[model samples]
Target: MIFIRKSNDRGRSQTKWLSSFHTFSFAGYYDPKFIEFGHLRVINEDTVQPGFGFEKHPHSNMEIISYVVEGSLEHRDSIGNGSVIKPGELQIMTAGTGIEHSEFNHSQMDLLHFLQIWIVPEKTNLTPSYQQITINKVLNQFVLIGSQNKQDGTVIIHQDVNLYVAFLTRNISIDYSLKANRKGWLQLVKGKIKLNNQTLLVGDGAAIQNEKINLQCIEDSELLFFDLSSN
Candidate 1:
């Protein structure tokens, strides 16, 4: 089975400096029917104006990953971790019991565009931690970014989810074999592509439950694929 979620169909939240689109129910945007998919809870695409950002916030029992597309986002947490994430970088945070963190634009005049992902943990109350990696070395193909066992040198998370990303050239095609009892979500972050027979543009999302996924790049593209265990 496959379901398509158009970019405009997503829930939207906009403030003076922040414009966010929620792939699942988040913040003030609520839709009971779209609460979550499998263990993939949230995928928020956010744009922040220069000199603006989110203040300290509390989270628990959730594994969060931050991917910067443009500009830079600065992160600070109660765990005494502070860093600036730039384009082609990722930040992972495990808010096990509880943790406080803040994300803000690291620049004074550049718009910050990024994706914030949330996945439910395999077990609760484990431990709070942080990890980061630079993906400039892995471009033009699907590469593991987050996983449970440090698989493929990905940032370890507290869930049975494996996150992969690709930077594909025009007219390229790639195949992914999806294991039985598992499902996947493909998100087109930039440019255009064809997932199986479905054409997806920027901000479009596709959920696939088939045994295999075939991606054909219509143009230069950036994509994120999540392989999640069926619960």
Candidate 2:
């Protein structure tokens, strides 16, 4: 089965400093029908003003990830990790036990655009940790960014999930197969693409179960793919 979540149909939270679109229920934007897909709980496409950002917030038992689409993101956490993440970079924080963090736009003039994702941990109360990596080594192919096993330089997360990223040129095609009893989520970061014959524009997301997927870029595009457990 496949379900397409249109970009325009997502929930929105807008303010003077931040403009965010939520693929699933988030904060004040709750939709009972779109709570989650498998273990993938949240996907927020956010654009922040040059000098404003989210204040310190607390989280627990959730795997948090940040993917910078444009500009730079400055992150500081209670765990003593502080850094500026730019395009083609990904950051993950395991909020086990409990942790507090804040995210801001590092640039004084450029608006920061990024995605923040949250996945429920397999088990609770694990140790908190952080990982970040540059994902520009390969192009037009799925590069593993995070997984349960930490394979191929991917960040280790406390869940049975595999996260892959791809940067494609126009007319390029790619194939992906979902294992038996597993699920998948495809998120379009920018540009246009055709997934399994269905078109997806920027900010669109697709949920798939038990299927072989084929993708062809209609334009230069960037996307993130998640292989998840059925449960």
The candidate scoring highest on lDDT is 2
Per-residue lDDT over 65-155 for candidate 1, one digit per residue giving the tens place of the 0 to 100 score: 9999899999999999999999888899999999999999999999999999999999999789999988744556779888889854579
Worst 10 residues of 1 by lDDT: 133-142
- Give the Cα error of residue 3 in candidate 1, in Å: 1.1
State model 1's lDDT.
0.91
Clashing pairs in 1: none
Per-residue C-alpha lDDT of model 2 across residues 164-183, encoded as one tens digit per residue: 99889999999999988899
Candidate 1's C-alpha runs over 4 A off are none
Q: Of the candidates shown, which would achieve the greatest TM-score relative to the real structure?
A: 2
The C-alpha RMSD of each candidate to the native structure, in angstroms, is 1.2, 0.9
Q: What's the TM-score of every candidate structure?
A: 0.97, 0.98
Query: Candidate 2 has what TM-score?
Result: 0.98
Clashing pairs in 2: none
**Model 2: CA > 4 A from native:** none
